[model samples]
Target: MIENVAALAHGFAVALTAKHILFMVAGVCFGLVVGVLPGLGAPNGVGLLLPLTFTMEPVSAIILLTSMYWGALIGGSTTSILFNIPGEPSSVATTFDGYPMAKSGEATKALTFAFLSSGFGALFGVVVVTLLAGWVTRFALLFSPVEYFAVFVLAFASFIAFGGGSPLKSVVSIALGLALASVGMDTISGSMRLTYDVPDLIRGISFLVVVIGLFGLGELFETMQNPAAAKPVATRLDLAGVVRAALEWPRYGVALLRSAVIGCWMGIAPGGPTAASFMSYGIGKRFSRNGPRFGKGEPEGLVCAETADQSAGSSAMLPMLALGLPSSATAAVLLGGLMIWGITPGPTLFSERPDFVWGLIASMYLSNIVAVVLALATVPLFARMLQVPFTITGPIIALVCVIGAWTVAGAPFDLWLLLLFGAVGWLMKALDYPIAPLVLAMVLGDRTEDAFRQSMLLSGGKLSVFFASPLPATITGLALLCLVVPLAGMALKPRTARSAAP
Candidate 1:
C-alpha cells in the first residue's frame, strides 16, 4: 500500500503538468458555473465540453472531465442550501436542512460544511478507487447478462422503494423510461421498431436530451407554476464569522466516515449518487440525537448528505473505468465520450493504458484540492446567486435547457423531445414518482435486453445455462436474497401486527 501511494505520488508530478493543470482549472471554473444553476447537472457540463476535448490527448481529456465532475459535486450544494433548489440530483437532500440553515442566516456555515465534507468524501472515493479497483474489476467480470439484468431490476426497484406517495406511479415512471429506451433501430436485428416514420427516431432518443429536458427544462416549467416560490434572492452571511466559530462546528467524523462508506457501497451497488445521498441522510437522521432537526435545519444532516453525494459522485467512476459499466449518469456520458475517442474501457484498459489510468487517478486528487479552493474563493459570488429573483432566473434556466437539448444532436427534433420529456418529468414529479428509475432504464435498458438474448443464444436456448456457471449461480442466490428478503419482510409485517393486536 505504501508502495502504491508512492507511485501515485509520482503520478501527481505528471498531473501537475502545466497543460493538465490548466484543464483542471477550466473544469473547476466551468463546474462552479454550471453547478450553481438549478437543474443543470454534471453530465450536461461534460457533454457541452466534450467536443472541445476532441483535440486533446486522452489523459488531458479524462483530467478535464473528471475535474469538472469533482467541482460540480462540490459546488452543487450552494444552490441547494441557499436557494432550496438542487443544482444536481445528488444535492437534493441537502435542501432539507441546508436551506433552512441559510434561511436562518447560517449560509456561510452550511457552505463551509459542504465544501469540507465534499473534499473529504471525494478523497475517500479516490482512495477506494485506487486501492480496490483491481478487485472490483474482477468482481464485475462475474456479471453475465442475467446478473446485469438483475442489477438493472434492483436499480429500478429503487423507484418503488423510495417512491413516497404511490408505488404504482413509480412503476409508471420506470415503464416510461423503458419504453423510451425501446425506440430507434434495433442493434441486433437492424430493424426500426418505433421510428414512427422519422429519420432521427431511427437513431433513437438520446438520453442526454431527455435528461436535460426532464430535470432542466422540466424544472423550469414546474417552477413557473409557482413563480413566487421559485424566486431567488440574495442573503447575507459572514464567512469570517463562520470560520472564526469553527470550533463550534458539528462533530462530523462519524458522519463523514459513515457517509463515505455508504456512498462507496451505493456506487458499487449501481444505484448512483441520488440514492447514496438520500440513504445517507436517512441513516444520519435515524442515528442522530436530534433527528427531528433534519428537515428543519441540522448541520449533522447536511454534512452527511453532502459527504455521501460527493463520495458517490467520485466513486461512481470506478465501475466505469475498471468494469466498462457506468455507475451513474455522468459516468455514462463519459462512457460515450470515451467510445467516441475509441477507447474501450475494461481490465484490459488498465493493462494497455496504464498512463491514462494513472493520469486519471492523479488528476482526481488534484481536482479535489482545486475544487475546495475554487468553491471557497467563489463563495461570496455564489452566495449572491440566491438573490436573483426567480422571474429573471427562470428564463435563464429555460434558455440553458434549450441550448443543452439542442447541443445533444444539433437538431431541432431533440428540442421537441425535450419538451415532451419535460412534460413527462413534471407529471412524474407531481405524482411523487422517483425519477432515478427512468434515467437508469434509459441507461441500461438496451444493454440488459441484448445481454439476455445473447446469453440465451450462446446457450442454444437453454434457460438452465444461466445457472450452470458458479458465478451465475452465486449471482442468482444473491438476486434471490435481494428479492426474497424484501418480500419476506413485507409478508411478516402483518403477522407481527396481528400478534401485537392480540
Candidate 2:
C-alpha cells in the first residue's frame, strides 16, 4: 500500500504540470464533441486524434488520448438521456430509462444521476487499478489461446441467454455477424475464404464501419420512419431535482457496488464497456425491488448502467498499461499510439517508465473528475440539443456517418459497406431482433477465430485441449451452462404447461 501511494504521489507530480493539465482539458472537450455527435465514437475519435499526438512526448500524448477517452465515455450519456439515441455502444442501456425520464420532464435528474454514477464508478476503477495493477498483469499473462477462445464463447453465450429477446432471433443475429466477419482473408494461412473476388473484401469489413452503419445511420433511418420523431422532446433543467436524486443514492448502495464489481470484472476480461453495461443493467433489473419499473424511467436503472459503463472504460486501461493487452477497440488504438510513440507497453513498462505509468494513472483520476464536472455543467446546453428537429439532425448524422466511414481507411468502398450494414440494422430493428449480440459478435469474431485456430493447431485438432487448463475449463463450462439453460427451459415448457392444464 505504501509503495502504491508513493508511486501515485510521483504520478500526481508528473501529471500536475501546466502543459499536461491543458492537454487534459483539450482532450476532454474534444471527447465530449465526439460523444455528442451521432456517428463519431471513442474509437474513431481517438483514431482521428492519434496522428496529431505523434510529435509529442509519449506521456503527454497518452494523457491527452486517455482523457479524451474518459470524456467520450461520460459524454455518451448526454445523448442517451436527452435523446433516445446512444452516442456510443456502451450508452445503449442508458437510453432504456434515461430517455423515458427526459420525456417525462425529469431530464435533469436522469442526466445528473448518470454523470454522478459514471464519476463514482470511474474513481472506483482507478483505485482498483492502482492497488491491483501487479496482480491483474500476472493474471492476464496466464491467458492462452484456449482461454481467450473460451472467454469469447462465454461472452456470446451470456448475451444470448440474458438478452431477453427471442433466443432464435439472437442466434440468427450472432450467426449473421460471424458470417460477415469471415468475409476477410484468413490471417493464419493467408487463404481466401469469403472474398467474392472483390478487392474490398480482401481487407474484410472494418468494425468501425459496421458500428457507424448499424448505430449511426441505422438510427437515422429508423427515426425518419416515425413522423413524431421530428418533434422536440419536453426537457426541463432542474438543479434542485438533481439534488433530490442524489439523496436517493443510499437506497441504491447494493446496486452500485454490484455494478462496479461487474464492470471491473468485464474490464479485466476486456469484454468492453458495451457488454459490461448490458450485463450490469440486466443484473440490476433482475435483483431490484423495483424490477418492473426498470425500463420505465427508473433512476436505479440509469445509475446501474452508467456506473458499469464508466467502470469498464476506466478498468480497460489496466490491461493496456500493465500487460500490453487492450480490453476494447479504443484501447487497441491507444496501444498502437503507444507503440508509435516508441514506448513498449508490457510488464516492463512500470519498471522502465514509472513516471509515465504513474502519471497516466494520475491523469485517469483527474480526467474522471473533470469529465463529470464538465458533463454536469454542460447538461443544459446538451439537453437543448434535443430541441432540434430530427429532420435536420438526421441529415447531419448521415453526413457525419459518411465522413466517419470514409476516414476509417480512406476508401469509398467503406461508405458503400456502411449503407449496406445500415440497411441490415434497419431490417433487424423492424423484425424486433436485438442488435447488441450482433454487434458484440462482430467485434469479438476475429479474436475468437484466431484463438480457436491457434488452439486447434497447438493441440493437433484435439478438442480435449480446451478442457486441459483450469481457467479455460471453468470458462468453457460456464459458457455451456449459459447456452444450455435457455434450451433446457424451452424444452421443459411444454411438459410443464401440459401438467398444469391437467
Candidate 3:
C-alpha cells in the first residue's frame, strides 16, 4: 500500500503537467459534444480520436482518451434529464427519474445530483483500482498459457452469461470476430489462410477501422433513421439550487454506497455500465424507503442510476489494464489503442511500464474532478446543443467517420470496409445483438489463439492441460459454469412456464 501510494504520488507529478492538463480539458470539451449528440457515444467518440494519438506519448494519449470518457459519461446525464433522451446507453436508467425531476422543476437539483454522484462513483472506482492494481498484477503473473487461455474463456463466458443478451448471438459475434482476426496469415505456419489473393486482405482487417464503422458510422446511420424530436427543457443552474442539492446529497448515502458496490462488481465481472445502472435502479426501487415513488421524479432514484453508471465506467478499466480483458466496448477500443502503441496489456505491463500505468491512475482522479466541474458549469450549453438538427450533425459525423477510417492506414479500401461493417453494426443493433463481445473478441482473438496454441505445445497436444493445475482448473471450471448456468436457465424457463400454465 505504501509503495502504491508513493507510485501514485509520482504519477501526480507526471499527470499534472501543462500539456496533459490541456489535453484533459480539450478531451472533456470534445466529449461533451459527442455525448450530447445522440448517436456519437463515448466508444465512438474515443474511436474517432484514436488516429490523432498515433504520434503522442502513450501516457498522454491515454490520459486524453480516458478524460474524454469521463466527460462523456457526465454529459450523458444532461440529455437524460433535460431532453428525455439518453445520450449514452448507460444513461437510459437516469431518464426514468431524471426527466421527471426536470419536468417537476428540479432540473438544477437533478443535474447537480447526477454530476456530484458521478464524481463520487468515479472516485470510489479509482480507489478500488489503486488498491487492487498490485494484487491483480501479481496474480496475473502466475498465469501460464493454460491459465491465460482459461482466463480468456472465462471473460467470454461471463459476457454470455451476464451480458443480458441472447447467448447464441454472443457466441456468433465472438466467432465472427475470431474469423476476422484469422484473416491475414497463420503466425506459426507462415502462410496466408484466409486471404484470397486480394492485396488488402494480405494485411488483415484492422480493428480500428472496424470500430470506427461499427460505432461511428453505425450510430450516425441509426440516429438519422430515427431522429430524436424531443425539445430541451429550458433551465439554468442556480447557485442556491446547487447548494441545496449538495446539502441533500447525504440523504441518499445508502443508495450511493449500494450502487457503487453493484457497479464495481458488475464492471469487474463483464457486466458493463449499462447493466450496472439498470441493476442498481431496479434494486434501489425494490429496497429504498421511497420504492413506490421511484419513477416519479425521485432524487434518490436518479442518484442510484448515475452513481452506478459512472462507477462501472471507471472500474471497467481495471480488468482492461491488469488482465487485458476489456469488459466494455469503450475499454475494447482503448485496449486496441494500447496494442497499437506497442504496449501490451496484462500483468507484465505494470512492471514493464510502471510510469505509464500509474500516470493513468493518477489522471483518473484529476480528470473526474475536472469532468464534474465542467459538466456542472456547462449543463445549459450542452442542453442548448441539443437544439441543433440531426440533419446537420449526421452528415458531419458521417464525414468524420470516413476520415477516421481512411486515416487508419491511409487506404481507400478501409473506407469500403467501414461501410460494410457499418451496415453489419446497424443490422446487429436492430437484432439486439450485443456488440461488446464482438469487439472484445476482435481485440483479443489473436492473443487468445496464441495462448491456446502455446498451451497445446507445452502439453504435447493434451486437452487435459487446462485442468492439470489448480489455477487453470479453477478458471476453466468457472468458465464452464458461466456457460452451463446460462444454458440451464434458458432450458428450464420454458418448462417452468409450461408447468405453471393454468
lDDT of 3 by residue, 1-502 (tens): 7888998998899999999999889888888777888668888889889888999999999999999999998899999999998888899999999999999888999999999999989999999889888888889889888888999999989888888767778888888988988889888887897898998998899888888788777777787778977687755799899999999998889999999989998888788899899999999999999889999999999999999999998999998998888888888899999999889998988888888999999999999999999998998777777887888878888888899888888999999999999998888887778887888898888999999999999999999999998999999999999999878776778455335423
* Per-residue accuracy of model 1 over 46-137 as CA lDDT, tens digit each: 76676567677878898988888888878888888877878787898998999888788777788788888888888898899888766766
User: What would you estimate as the lDDT of candidate 2?
Assistant: 0.80
Which one wins on TM-score? 3
**Model 1 segments beyond 4 Å from truth?**
1-14, 51-58, 103-105, 142-154, 157-167, 229-239, 245-250, 289-296, 480-502
In angstroms, what RMSD does candidate 3 have relative to the true structure? 2.4
Compared with the true structure, model 1 gives a TM-score of 0.86
- The runs of at least 3 residues in candidate 3 whose Cα sits more than 4 Å from the true structure, single-residue gaps closed, are 492-502
lDDT score at residue 388, model 1, on the 0-100 scale:
71
State every prediction's TM-score relative to the real structure.
0.86, 0.77, 0.96
18 Cα displacement, candidate 2 (Å): 5.0
- In terms of lDDT, the best-performing candidate is 3
lDDT of 2 at 438: 69
